[model samples]
Target: MQRPAYGQSPPLHHPVPQHVSTVPQLRSPPPPIPQQQHQQQAHGYDGSPYQQQPMGAGPSHNVFGQYGNFMNDPAAQLASQFSQTAFKQGTQYLEQNVNRYVNVSALKHYFNVTNSYVINKLFLVIFPWRHKPWSRKQTVGPNGQEGWYLPPRDDINSPDMYIPVMSLVTYILLSTLIAGLRGQFQPELLGYTASKALGVVVLELVGLKLGCYFLSISNESQLLDLVAYSGYKFVGVIGTISLAEIVNKGKGTGGWFGWSVFLYMFLANSLFLMRSLKYVLLPDNHGDARGPMQTGDTRAKRNQRTQFLFIYSYVVQFAFMWFLSRP
Candidate 1:
């Protein structure tokens, strides 16, 4: 190569060569510097302004707190800690079934009917009937000696016996008619004493009778009128039992107590009234099944004998009624 003059430019030409040698040159690219590829993880976006810290390590973000200092405080854990979130969760849970509907009007009517029946029964329990006094007499014989015949004590003061006995009889007849009308003839269903069923009938009848009498709506008692009201109580009890059984986790034991003890009051009172009936209604009816009357026989046979005595005793009742009707 020769340097060109300052004033003249060199001519661009290739020189003719007799022989040529070629050499390969090696130049490596700068060792690729590992350019870190920033990636987004589940915790946060790659370009997020705020940094994420390990959970429970630093001050926790208290969703519900007066000051950030109380954020990580375990003692501050409360329902309000995530109240809005919890409320949202709860709202979503409830909203999932918001379309569900219940028969509220029917339930309300049913409760009304039950309360009405209870009120009527209370009236029957409190109302005073004519009190009959037992009469004793001393007979004077030819020798001027007085022989005394002891009089039995009447049960005017016993509310338990009186209320239950009257209620039972009234209910039996009332429910029999209701069941008969509903095209049911299974007397066995009637054979079992269900206080609530019986209460329904008796209270309904009493309510209808009293309402009609008081309001001067009608003097006569129709079978349908009693059945209609009793049906209400019956339906009410069924509804209550159904709701408690279905909606509550508690077992049916509590329901049984409610049915047996409070609503029915049948078992305890039945024993009492059954005992009183023998002594009060059938004195001569000496059936072990009978109250004070003593007899040796099976329960069924005793009941049969006692029924006959009861029929006989009713003659005395009619006579007493007739005497009372006298001026």
Candidate 2:
């Protein structure tokens, strides 16, 4: 090493530094500060008190959370209650309207029956020859009326709407099935078939009403009874059609065997009606206590009514069956 002079020019030499290692040294990171200490440090830096808030302590941060809060709101709860009350009131109004025209309690009686009664009634409708005493058994009703007929559960001869309703529905479904099998089915065909069946029922009802009016035998309660008896023909019609289908195997409704089955069913149904309607048409012969005492003119009128009953049981049934069975 050489030193430089203060005032005079002189040669100078710089000192050499020491060598440093090229490899890096490893060191652990410092431990994290506590939450309180961190918050205090932030407060000191900002000159204000810093609050450490818990998770979700502020306003809702997600859509689901906001929706939950809204549902708990009092306004939303009140709206829900109002909708429920409106629905109940609407249901009550509809029920009141329906009960105005229809006798629901009386209708329920015709549907009161058991499996055994259904089976036995079906047998009687199909094969009515051996059955005796077509008269219905009378029973004391809840109101103590004496003329009320026994429920179908107790008497197989009693008329019931159950079989008729079930048979009618089955007939419509079967008709649709047969039409589909025969390749004559259409979407509109269902509506057409239903309309036609309902129309036939309406026409028959109208004719019966007209006949009763002319014969001076009009009755409101008996209307349901007449409808039930008239609907029994559907059972035979169903049997005849089903047999015809099975025999022909979806081919058609025309054959010697089909015709034979149809003729037999028609005759059986005619006989069933003849026996069943005797009580309704000729109340005098059946010993109905509700009927008035017979007079000479009433007796003569009953003779004419007897002829009408025969015509209805045979002629009307045959015509209707033939029409229904047509392909």
Candidate 3:
């Protein structure tokens, strides 16, 4: 055969060298660049594999579907399962033990600030109002003339009347006694209130104990229950007595009023016990007036009736409050 011209390609009809055909077989489409490679190339380079995929497949499909399979691989699945298990366990532990994290010492501080706190400094200023004469005396003058006058014994400032020590002590004693006495009677509603009051005390104690054990707080005072229960009685009795007076004034009679007073008095007392907080809060505006019973004044005698009226009014108010505080 004649030699080919210099630099001329071989004839198209001529058979190609076996090596050229073998080279194409060796290339073999490169096993379609593994999914990971496509992912890397799609993200790492300017061109996107999403653009090359079928039109029906969205961009998210190309990015996630290709890689999501590996994320769900056996080893990855096991790691994910372990992570979920640990997370659930941690959450459950926190839920079951969160009470331990509560700061119950704060509750004690709140209680001290709210109940039985003797702020004598502020009280010293307010106590004077109790001494001011609530009522004045009047009598017929000589020669059939009417005259208004102060009582012969007008000592409006009496330490004993305003101090409230006796009232507090008496209230506490009477409350305990009445609660004990009445508890045996098993009156339907009154007994219910008493039982619930006991339950509240128990729950408070339980909370206190748990708080102490887990949170390192302490609540060792037994008087807390006493004061709490006493407060209830104080309010309940005061309210009941007041309501009885109002009822007696309007629609009630002797025996009816007396029994009504007895029945409602427990409600008033319960209110007092429930709202022990009232002992601590007071008005800031108090003038330096004379005491409840001043030196040598019979105003106390005339005003004693008024005081009794006030006591009864307070009883009615206390009963209402107790009813509201239930549950």
Best by the lDDT measure? 2
Tens-place lDDT per residue, model 2, 1-327, is 777678888757787655547556789975566865775444443234464544553343456698899999999999999999999999989878988987777788799999999999999998899999888888787898777777788998888999988988887888988999888888987887777767777787788778877777634466778888878878877887898899899766689988998899899999998988777776763457554324544667988879888998999989988887776
Give per-model TM-scores. Answer: 0.19, 0.73, 0.20
Write one digit per residue (lDDT tens) for candidate 3, span 1-327: 998999998788967687765564445453455876776555653256554444435576768886888897999889999999999999978866864854444223223321222333123222323323323234554565543222212312111112232333443344344445445333354556555545544554454344324422222322332333333343334434345445655332235655666555543333332232111111011221211222343544434434432443355334433443322
lDDT of 2 at 22: 57
* Regions of candidate 3 where Cα sits further than 4 Å from its true position: 1-102, 113-176, 179-191, 196-327
Q: State the lDDT of candidate 1 residue by residue for 237-261, as single tens digits.
A: 3333334434433343154443443
Instruction: Candidate 1: count the clashes.
Output: 0
TM-score-wise, the better of 1 and 2 is 2
RMSD of each: 23.8, 10.5, 25.7
* Prediction 2 global C-alpha lDDT: 0.80
The runs of at least 3 residues in candidate 1 whose Cα sits more than 4 Å from the true structure, single-residue gaps closed, are 1-195, 219-223, 253-327
Model 3 residue 6 CA deviation in Å: 99
Order the candidates by TM-score, highest first: 2, 3, 1
